[model samples]
Every structure is written in C-alpha cells, then in structure tokens.
Target: MKGDLSTLVFTGCETSGCEMSRSRQYDIKRFCFQTWYYDATEGRCSQFWFGGCGGNENKFATQEMCETICVEPPGRGRCYLPRVDGPLRCDQLQPRYYYDYTKKHCVAFWWRGCLGNANNFNSFEECSVFCKDVGPFDEPTTTTVPPPAPQNIQQFAPTPEAQQIDIVSAEQPQQQPQ
Candidate 1:
C-alpha cells in the first residue's frame, strides 16, 4: 500500500466509496483486473473513479477495478428496478458485500456487468482500465445495506471494553520469510 496509486479520470476527485481493487482482481479474458485501492472516503468518483462506458449510465464496470480490460459490468440479468432511483442508477439489483482491508469497513455494491475481456492479464494495472470505463449504475443484483454493527442501543447497558474488531481479513494470510 506504500506506493498504491489513487486514480481519477476526469476532475480526479479522489472519491468513489469503493475499495477491493486488490481483492476482486480477476481475469476477464487476456487482461488482468486488480482492485488495488479502496476509497477511504466517498462523495463522488473522481474522473478516474467514475470511468466511462461505451453506453449510457446504465452500463458501468465495478467501482473496484481489476485491470484495464477486465471489469464488473451490467450483464443481461433479471434486475428489479426500485420505485425511487436508488444509489446505483442501473435499476433494482442485489448488492454484493466485500470486506475491505485498506478502509477497514465492510463495503457494499450491486453487480451490474461482467469483465470486458474475460482474460486475466499479468499486471494488476492491466484490468484497471475497465474500472475507468464503467461507472455506478443499477446493479442487476445489489443493495447498499452494510451489515449492522454493535452500538449501544440500550441506554442502561454497560459499554463493552472493546469497540469492535477489524473486519478486513486478508484472504491469504501473509507468511514471514525465514
């Protein structure tokens, strides 16, 4: 994370309530997509944060990018459009949840589309371009409901000694070199 780069395509707002750039990294075809950075803050995706699609706002890659080619897209799926235009403008889609380590938060977003290429390339930067093209939309399956955390709902209840545990657990535990 020392040299981790923050991306912005247009004004470069450094926004985009997203992370998992390093976690959801995947292969869409010949390219590699890596979620290298997660947004520690949110308001709007910077120019690079909100990538542009070949089509309207309906089409967007995941907020998290894998590479330049590979990306999460709004594929042909049965999506339920909400009465009110929800956060993801696509329609009514189920939200997917991921534990973000960099942000130390459980992030949520709707799956809107598929990876552009489908082939996994080498560098994590390869698939990042896909993120540049896709923006937030009506994820065919998604919602923005972060699982509830422990708060003092009872006024009389005694406060616990600890606040909460860090939810960001690395998939592969790091091993120390001998």
Candidate 2:
C-alpha cells in the first residue's frame, strides 16, 4: 500500500525493512505467530514471535523468504572472518558454532541473536563442512575409543535361599477370627 511494484522486486542487497527492529502489539487481544526476519546487523535471518496486529515489512513467513528478500549470498573468505556476537540490545543467548582460524577447528560461542557475522553456524558439523578447506594445511586425525564394557550386576543380586527367607518373613500369618 506504500511503495510501487518495483519495491517488491529485490534488485539489491540493501533493504531498509531488514534494518527495522521486530515489533509486536502489546494489547491484551494480541494474536502471536512465529515469523522470520532478516537481521541486517548480523547478516542473517532469525525467528521471532510476531503479534498478529502490528508488524513491519521486515516480517517474513519463512527464513528463505527473509533471506531472499534481504540477505546477501555468502562470498569467498567468509570463513576467515572474525566471529561476531551481534548487538547487545537484543540480549538473547543463542548457542552457536564458528570456525576458529587460529585453532584450525570449530568452537562453540554464545550468539546474542541480533547482529553477528556469517561465520556463525548452528552446529559444529555445519561450520566444519562449510570452512573445511579454509583451515589447517594437514587433515586432523581422530582416534575412536570403544565404550567401556557393561558391568556384571548379577554378583550384587541375592541368592535363591536369601530371597526365599526374605519372602517368607515378609508374609504375615493369617489372623484368627475374633
């Protein structure tokens, strides 16, 4: 209802809608739904609960829609970039994984969920695969250790005679009629 049809088409990466903060109606009659929004500061899409009434153009039905509308595709050397925890204004602790160029491996970090960099990943495996070629020159070796054998609990069990004695003691004799 505001911009022309050209505004609907994504011609460039920059979108003011992406930069807008998420909003939700605070009224008692508010109806909330989960939605995705492009976090321009973090350069990624994130989920947020939206109140059905008042929201901005930043809201999207899915992560894909948000990305297609606002996020720029990953470029070369993305893995080499430093990890970002995003802005402190949002203060949502999200556990994330990122490739550590110095360590030559993926490590865990707490993402503030608003404005981090593309180096952030949802899992260690995701980070490893994405930046596999960017790390150490030599492939890291891993040693697999078999799990310990199950203990023999039979030794702790009571013998048949002991069990029988306990059962007999536990039984009460029939009471005579008064």
Candidate 1 ranges beyond 4 A from true positions: 1-66, 69-89, 109-178
Q: Identify the candidate with maximal TM-score.
A: 2
Give one digit per residue, the lDDT tens place, for model 1 in 131-168: 32334322223333633422221112223645543334
In model 2, what is the error at residue 84, expressed in angstroms?
A: 0.7
Residue pairs in candidate 2 whose N, alpha carbon or C atoms collide under 3 angstroms: 42-115
Per-residue CA lDDT of model 2 for 51-126, tens digit only, reads: 7776777788888766655543344244544566665465445678766666777767766667655677887678
